[model samples]
Target chain A: MQFKYDLEGGNFSRAGHASSEVKKILKQLNVDARIIKRIVVALYEGEVNVVAHAHKGVVMVDIDEKRIYIRIEDEGPGIPDINLAMQEGFSTASASVREMGFGAGMGLPNIKKNTDQLNIESEVGKGTVLEMTTMISS
Target chain B: MKISEIVDVLNARVVCGSDKLNTEVRYAFASDLMSDVLTLDTENLMLVTGLANLQVIRTAEMADIFCVVFVRDKKATPEMKKIAEENNIVILESPYSMFRAVSVLHDCGLQPVY
Candidate 1:
């Protein structure tokens, strides 16, 4: 099964909509709790990243018997240094965003920690696209 | 420990999931940072946070946390309560500050996730 959802930048109010929906779908499929937790953690972090940094974003999820895949594409000021952004404490978020309990700079690291496979592509003036996959069966 | 015991000890109000008071949680972690909360990889956990937002509920859901204790008299909004109900996660509003509440719970034998 596959699903898609749109996300608005700076819309902290609705940041986790897509992740929550995907969680329900995973539950309905009786996916293993450990696998589902990893996916939800990664996907929710991705969703928050879009809301915090992008102009807007889209999440695409594909699940089958063996794997669950997620593609997140966002239009924003793309990261100039993916390596720097991947650092655990590196952050560009403002104080206001931090007060809301986000922007702690652990987003990307957490995503990488939870996903089985991850690929990131970006252009400084354009946007970023992240592809993450997790094996669900076997 | 049973969530009901927390209510009694912390003088917390059950914002939702009153029926789930009987639900038991083994670990308690307190943090306002949702990212820190996300990294938790355990079962039957309770999160004590000062953040009262949709994201808090979402974090708990994603992390598979069983109960949330909102410190410093924070209460969940209607939307947050609605989603918490759907997910069967308990929400408790405590009158105590984060430190006092966490200390009390720890003294009451609630184990730490660390």
Candidate 2:
């Protein structure tokens, strides 16, 4: 199964809708709690990153029996240095984002920690595409 | 600590999931940073934050947090409340500041998850 959500840039109010829905769907499907938690965390972090930094984006979630995949594509000022951005304390978020309890520079790191696989592709001025997957254990 | 006691200590208004008042919270984490809460391996935890948004409830749901308390009179929107309800998360609104709320809960035996 697959689900998609359009993430509105700078719209903190609607940021986690996709992730929440994913959680519900996983629960209804009786996925393991630990696996569901990992998917929710990874997807939510990606969602927030798109909202905070991108112009706008789409989150596409694909679920299979063995693994769950999430692809977040955003049209934004893409990361200049992917390595630096992956660091735990590196963030370019404005003060407003920090005030809302985000932009702590842990977004990328948290997403990486929660998922079994992660790939990020970006250009300085074009956009970013984040592909993450978590395997389900039998 | 029972979620109902935490509500009483903070003098908070229950916004949703009142049926979960009897839920036992073993540890508490107070942070406005949702990512920090995500990194912590806490189960049956209580989240105290001034941040009011749908994501807070979403974070709580993912982390298996038992309850969320909004400090400093932070009011949640109707949509946020609805999401909390859907997640079966206990929501409370308190006039107490974050520091005070944490202190009250700490004094009453709620320790941080570290």
Candidate 3:
């Protein structure tokens, strides 16, 4: 199965809408609870990252027999340095984003920790694309 | 611990999911950072946070944490409460600071998830 959801850049209110929907679908499909948690965490962080940094983004989800795949593509000021951005405590979040308890520089690291396979593609001043995959079966 | 017990111990108000006060939670993780909360892997975990926002409920929903205790009397907005109710996650607003709430829960034998 496949699904897509759009997200506005600065809309914190709607940040996790897509993640919540995907979680419901996974549960209805009887995905393992542990695996579902992993998928949702990664996806939620991805969704938050887009809301925090990008102008706008789209989330795509694909579920197969063995694994679940997700892609988040956003139009925004892309990460200039992927290595530095992956560090645990680095952030360029605005004060408003920080007030909501995000932009702690932990989102990508959390995403990497929860997902089995991850890839990030970005171009400075242009956009970013994040792809993640997690095994659905134990 | 039962969710009701947490409500009593922290002198918290149930912002939503009143019917789930009897829900049992064995572990608790406290943090304001949603990223840290997202990295958690466990069963029956309750998140203790200072920020009462939409993402807090969203984080709990994504992490499969059915209970969240908002420390320092932070209020959850109506929208947050509504979404939390739909997700079957209890929202507790406590007057205690994060440190005090965690200590109280710890003294009551709530196991830490570290």
Output the number of the lDDT-best candidate.
1
Put down candidate 2 lDDT per residue, A1-138, tens digits, no spaces. Answer: 998999999998888889888988898888988888888988888988998899999999899888888999999999999999999999999997887778889999989999999999998888999999898766
Q: After superposition, how far is residue A138 of candidate 2 from its true place, in Å?
A: 3.5
* Chain B TM-score of every predicted model: 0.98, 0.96, 0.97
Clashing pairs in 3: none
- lDDT per residue as tens, model 2, B1-114: 888898888899999988888888878898889879988766668899998877788788778786889999999899878878877888999999899988889899988898
* Second chain TM-score for model 1: 0.98
Q: Which ten residues in a row have the lowest lDDT in candidate 1 chain B?
A: B35-44
lDDT of 3 by residue, A36-138 (tens): 8889888999999899999999999999889999999999999999999999989999989988889889888888988999999999999999999999886
Candidate 3's residue-wise lDDT over B5-111, tens digit each?
Answer: 99999999998889998888899999998877877788989999998789899989998899999999899999988989889989999999999999999999899
Q: lDDT of each model, Cα atoms only?
A: 0.92, 0.88, 0.91
RMSD of each: 0.8, 1.4, 1.3
CAPRI classification of candidate 2: medium
Put down candidate 1 lDDT per residue, A2-25, tens digits, no spaces. 899999999988888999999889
A best-first ranking of the candidates according to their TM-score comes to 1, 3, 2
Off by over 4 Å in 1: none
Error of 3 at A91 (Å): 1.7
Q: For residues B1-114, write the lDDT of model 1, one tens digit per residue.
A: 899999999999998899989887789999999889988787889999999988999899899997999999988999999999989889999999999999999999999988
